[model samples]
Target: MFRQLKKAATFAAAVLATTTLVSTAQAADYPEKAITLVVPYGAGGASDLAGRALAETARNYTNEQPVVVVNKTGNGGMNGARYVTEQKPDGYTLLLSRVGMALYPAVYTDSPVAWDDYTFLGILESTPMILAVNANSDIKTVDELLAKIKSSNGATTYAASGPTAIDGFTVQALLADADLDPLSASTLVPYKGGSALAAALLGGHVDFLAIAAGSLMPHIEAGKMRALMVYAPKRMDALPDVPTAKELGYNLAGQVDGWSALFAPKDLPEDVVAKWKDILSNVATNDQWLDLAKKRGSVSVVGDQDPAAFVKSQYELYNGMAKKFGYIQ
Candidate 1:
């Protein structure tokens, strides 16, 4: 009986050792093929541009393995986010996370994805929000725009990715701060991506919009759009004359800004996570990545904070805002 028990224990130990070895080998051989970096928004948007830049720069550290970006737009950016969470956590499928990742779960009681569903690799960049109107529009300032909305009695429309998205929250929070009904003071016209949101304002379909500065900077510079205010902690260097929401006393709007980060399905191996941390560190300092961010009116912020803690803090902030602004109970 003693001999039989000893033999069983030895077999179990060998099995465990083999399993550990195989898992280690798998993690070490990560990205043997091209890795898919899914962008939750459409092409020509801030998230897409950030994903492509990171993918391009990551090649230097990835041994030339391609990081292919795939856009899966819809449902206020949840469709793509959900798709990524459902993928294998093999370090091959990743997400180019956006501000919507935190905002949606806070605002929507039935949000498809939770803020903590993915493993946050790191924050890539922050794209400040800009409130703007068509250059030809008669409205020239945020105050004038709010007055029009109040006088129009809900006729003034604004474009956003959706009511729960970061862009939408920017306008809603601003209205709420001004002692207006965020939902009824103006109409919210939903668009799928940044390009669509910008087009709505430029084509006169929507009266105004507050969205990522990267998507609106070109038009603002080209004299096609007039920026009313910036939704960042400080004024952007490119738009130094524009006042920030904090300076204007819109606390809620001032707290909300657009950002992009890297994420993967939860439960990723530690080895894989370490590998990505090294790659992202290199990409953050790459000249090409820095130049792209500068031209897009964004600030590169990789490794500036703990990604998981930053995401959690953002969730807590929006959750509090949702409760305060009546978006949730």
Candidate 2:
């Protein structure tokens, strides 16, 4: 009986040692092959652009492995999230983690994964949503827009690609803050992606659109749209003249800061996580990456706080916001 117990203990120790050794070896050769950054949104959207930008500059601070951007659209970002979470936890496949990860689970009845299911790597950048109207429209300020909505009697239209997406809730929260019913004041039109929403706004299909400033910058610069209010803690340098929601007596902007992070599947090796945390920290400061971020109007969240803590805090913050906004029961 003693010999049998001793044999079992020794076998267990050997298995543990072997597993640790394999994980260490895998970490040493991490990214020996190309890495794929999966973006849940379709092409030309803000998330897609950020994913492509990160892929382009990943080698600047990490291994020379080619980082490819792949867009897997549908199911309110669940499809792409599932693809990465179900992939090997070797840090090869990554999700361009979006606010939806924290939000969908709170609001959507069919969320496939929760926040804790992801290996929180680090956040790279974040930006606040902006409310804008077509350049040709007479609405020029937040008050005017609110008045228009209050009087439109559901005649005014707004476009949000997905009902549960950041834009959708943002527009809802904005209207609600202004003492108007988001549902009764105007009709919320759904589009496929940012590109479609932009087209609709530009072609007079919608009265105004709420979206990330980065996605609307090119159009605004082209004189196709004009920003009215920014949902940020303060004014953005990119749109210095635009007032924040707080300035307009609406305090919802600070709650709407959307962020994007680099995340792997759960149980990723610690060494790999450290490697990516270091790489992303450096990438956030790299001149090329910073220049791209400025052009896109995204603020770098790297080095601002602990990555794991930031992810957890943001999840909680969005969860509370989801409840406050009545997205969840």
Which of the numbered candidates is closest to the native, going by highest lDDT?
A: 1
Cα deviation of 307 in candidate 1 (Å)?
A: 1.6
Model 2 C-alpha lDDT per residue in residues 206-265, reported as the tens digit of each score? 999888878788899898899998877778888899988778776554467677788899
Write the residue-wise lDDT of candidate 1 on 205-281 in tens digits: 99999999998999999999999999876889899899999998888888888899999999998999999999999
- All candidates' lDDT scores? 0.90, 0.82
Residue 21 in model 2: shift from native, Å? 3.3
Q: Worst ten-residue run, lDDT, model 2?
A: 250-259
Model 2: clashing residue pairs?
none
Model 2: residues >4 Å from true position, as ranges? 1-15, 308-329
Superposed by TM-score, candidate 2 places the C-alpha of residue 297 at a distance from the truth, in angstroms, of: 2.5
Name every residue pair that clashes in candidate 1.
none
lDDT of 1 at 65: 89
